[model samples]
Target chain A: MDVLSLPFIQHAILAGILASVACGIIGSLVVVNRSVFLAGGIAHAAYGGVGLAFFLSLPPLPCIIGFSLFMALIMAAFTVERRHRMDTFIGVLWAVGMATGIILIDLSPGYNVDLMSFLFGSILTVPVSDIKVMAAVDILIIGAMCGFYKEFLAMSYDMEFARVRGLPVRLFHFLFMALVALAVVMTIRVVGLILVMALFTIAPYLTERFSASLAGMMVTSTIANIVFVFTGLWISYRYNLTSGATIILVAALFFMIFIILSRFASCPRKP
Target chain B: MAPGGDQQTTVLPEGQSRAGEVPDVEIENCSFAFNSVPVLRDVNIRIYHGDFVAIIGPNGGGKTTLVKLMLGLLKPQKGRVRLLGSDPAKSCRRVGYMPQYSTGEKGFPITVMDVALLGRLGLTGIGCRFTREDREAALGALRLVGMEKYMNKRIGDLSGGQIQRTLLARALISNPEVLFLDEPMASIDIDGQSMLFDLLGELNKKMTILFVTHDVGLLSRYIKSIICVNETVYFHHEPKISPDMASLMMGTGEKCPVEMVAHGIPHRVLGRHERD
Candidate 1:
């Protein structure tokens, strides 16, 4: 109860809710489209933005957002025509982006910040300004998704069919990549870059067991993420453990439990 | 039919003929290629309203390419493609397409209803709710394919035939003027295939249809005309295949010019070709 009264803790809670909004919506798309690898590359490549922000002494939120968006566009363009060879290009970008971040950080004058927080999240340290940024991004993501819902669903289900129906499949793809970039950047504050994909993927994957449609999956995933974030926060506060790691650990535990239960439930007669 | 089968363009003067009489689709001197390799060259086709046409050719013979050009999924390097008297891409909302089964992802998490509702996406740009009308249309399409009971069912849970039917419902939900189907028979059983062809035949009374498949023998009975596509195209206005033409189509003789079949072909052999 005392922790609830603390402003930092309250900010952390707000950040968690906003992160769940993205994790629920964009994460469902990422899982359904089976673009987990592409999302992972973008998430990791986002570190370049963090490095750039540090080097430029700019506000990390917009700087990282811009950098991640630029990287996502490049990835989208590369994968458009030569999809069979996409993995090679994605891998190259992943490495190069990370390398650029590390070199930039090293070159930055007297920028000796603790890198672990950026890598693994520092939700308790999320400032009010960052929370505002997260909220704006949440609004942006939700609004775009609502406006492009059918187009996204059609493209996800059958891209060629969407293309034939006069849907701008390529344009939607680039826009979706940009959204993914924004989601990754906003989420980095709550779950950190290294573990963000887990949060992005796990909720939707777990919800798929019961959800019949993409919208259902998103709703169920949002609720599940809320549960995970709150429970993980309480447990981390009690044990004085790392909040991001604890949240992911809680989700992983639920994932394992569901797997075991579903396996048995599906084949109850099996030995 | 043109007396000489070299090039035929029957575009009616603007505002001369009634809308119903205008050809549903027209392609003139269309050429397409992937990479440096040419897939289709100098192809021309006209599909009138209410025509049930089958596009049949050997594997890699550009059947799919011609369909793509017509649907505006791919641009022809040099040609004009018109659908419903406009650019195919611009009038695409009036076109329904069922791509090959292999293109659909198996084990994807989606319901039959949601898949069918994809047809209604063109009715409005994003943000609007799925209206009651949209739902009813989707349901009606599902009923057409006899999968209304499975509308709520997950697509992955259905059998191959059931999935194909669901896809048909998706394409039909829009109530388009023309339907383009690519190898839709690949996964269905013979009975299901028969029923599907029957459904397409019934639909042809109101809509033009362009079916792309290599299994011409199975489809020739229902289709009213055939378009044979290789690197080039040969448009056959009639489905009644002469015995000699049938033999040539089956690769029994040296390749005769497709134009020869329109006029009674002399005994010219066709180059041996393999069926897909």
Candidate 2:
């Protein structure tokens, strides 16, 4: 209770909740579209933005947003035009982006930036400005979800059919990728770049079986993500563990338990 | 009713007089390629209103590609494609397309009703919720496909045949004047296939239907014409195919010159090839 009264702890919890909003919504979309790999590429590629921010002395949030968006657009183009070779391209981008980030960070003189924070997250130290950015991003994601819910649902389910219905499938694909970029960047604050994919995928994957609709999945996944974040934060605070890794471990625990229980439930029984 | 005969005359079903007017779908000198490998070359096809066409060919012979071209999902490398008297992209809202059933994204969270309602996506404004009328129409479409009982079921939980029928319901919900189904019969059983054809026959009275399938043996009484595609396009006006034409479709023979006539109860001399 004393920890809850601490301003930094409160900020960390707020950051966790804001991050969950984006995670739940965009994560559901990523899972349904089966673009987890693509999102992973975008998440890792966002490190280029972080390094660029540090090297150029620019703000990290906007730099990461712009760089991740550029990567997302390129990936989206590859997906639309050369789907067969998309994985290869994503692999190349993933490696190149990470290498570029590391090189840029190394080249930047006299900065002494905490690279581990970007990789493994620093939720306890998440500044108020970062919290504001995360909240703004959450608003943008919620607005987009509300406005284009059906179109997204249709596009995600059967892209060709959506195209036949004149739904601008390619445009949606690009828009979705951009949203993924934004979500990845925001999630970096709570879970770091390396662990963002877990936050984006695990909850949605767990919720998809019980959810009968995409909206339902998004809602349930968001709630599940919030639960994971809160529980992970409490455990991390209690044990002085790494918060981001703890959050992901919490989600993974739920995932494994759900999988095992479901397997047992579905197993045939003798009369 | 004859195979390999003089191109059969356009026979309009009763109460339909739109034939010989503006073609419902017209592709002129359409050429498409992938990675410099040509899939369709100089493909010219004109389908009239109320016509039922079956596009059949071997794997990699571009049966699905041709349908995708017509649906504007893929643009031809060369030539113009017009659907419903306009560009396919502009006129797509008026067309219903059921792509070949793909086992995409296992456990994708969507209900049969949700899928059916997606058919009304083009008709509704962006950001708007589906209305009560939309739900009723979806229900009606589901009923048409005999999927009404499973409206609440997740699409991923359904059988292959059930998924196909749900997709068919989605295609039909929009009430398009032209329908394109790619390999829709691949998963359904024999009884389901006949029933689906019977339903399509009833639908043919109001809308033109173009379906791509490898089951040439299932060409029913409703198919008014056949388009044999294999790196090139041949428009057969009759439903039945001669052995020579079948061999041509199989990509194993040169162009057959003789027009052998076989009438009544469509059957195939070719065995079933593996589906892509």
What TM-score does chain A of model 2 get?
Answer: 0.96
List pairs with backbone clashes in candidate 1. B253-B269, B253-B270, B254-B269, B254-B270, B254-B271, B255-B269, B255-B270, B255-B271
Query: Which digits, one per residue and each the tens of the lDDT, describe model 2 over residues B119-172?
Result: 998899877889999999999999999999999998878889999999899999
Please identify model 2 stretches exceeding 4 Å from their true place: A269-271, B1-20, B251-276
TM-score of each: 0.85, 0.91
Model 2 docking grade: medium
**Best candidate per lDDT, number?**
2
Top model by TM-score, which number? 2
Residue B70 of model 2, lDDT score: 88
Error of 2 at A218 (Å): 0.9
Give DockQ per model, in order: 0.46, 0.64
As a TM-score, model 1 comes out at 0.85
Off by over 4 Å in 1: A80-84, A268-271, B1-22, B240-276
Could you give the CAPRI-style class of model 1? Answer: acceptable
